[model samples]
Target: MDELIDHSFKLIAKILYFLVRIFAWLIFEFLYEEIAWWLGWCICRAITLNSRPTVGINGYDEATTTTRFVVCFTGIATIILAGTILAIYISANAT
Candidate 1:
């Protein structure tokens, strides 16, 4: 009788495991494509923003533009990349 009960419990646990797996798969599979597209868009935007040429307004010296642009781009790219990495780490840890 004890053996039978143990076997039945094992079977129930297996079923529950499979059910959870299936549910997670369904949720992720449905959202994966949209999530990928949005992530790609965000990365592309970040890259473009970082690499775009800087337009100087009044009082801006052409000689200093390149240096300033490089500094700004480096700072912005660093922040963006760091934020993205942190977000991914947080999400991965959450799961």
Candidate 2:
């Protein structure tokens, strides 16, 4: 019985993880380009606000940085979110 319950929980966790990954991938695929461009532009503008000459960073560099940042941010967020949801589900279902 204990083994069964443990296996069931593991299955649930796996399903949740898979669903979250799919959702995150879909969102990233559809929005990363535009979001990266906007984020890069904003950061560049802020950095060059008081300077006479703009930085030499090109769009590709900005996009790369933005992509890294977004990926890290989303990865952390997804883990936290999934953990929270799993905790809540387990707590509610616990005896």
Which candidate has the highest lDDT of all? 2
**Residue range 23-90, candidate 1, lDDT tens digits:** 99987544432333334334444777744333322212342655444544455565578899999999
**How far does residue 53 in candidate 2 sit from its true spot (Å)?**
21
> RMSD of each candidate?
15.7, 12.8
lDDT (CA) for every model shown?
0.57, 0.60
TM-score of 1: 0.38
Ten residues in sequence with the least summed lDDT for candidate 1 = 52-61
Q: What value does the lDDT take at residue 24 in candidate 1?
A: 92
Candidate 2, poorest ten consecutive residues by summed lDDT: 51-60
Give the TM-scores of the predictions, in the order they appear: 0.38, 0.37
Clashing pairs in 2: none
Clashes of each: 0, 0
TM-score of predicted structure 2: 0.37
Residue clash pairs of candidate 1: none
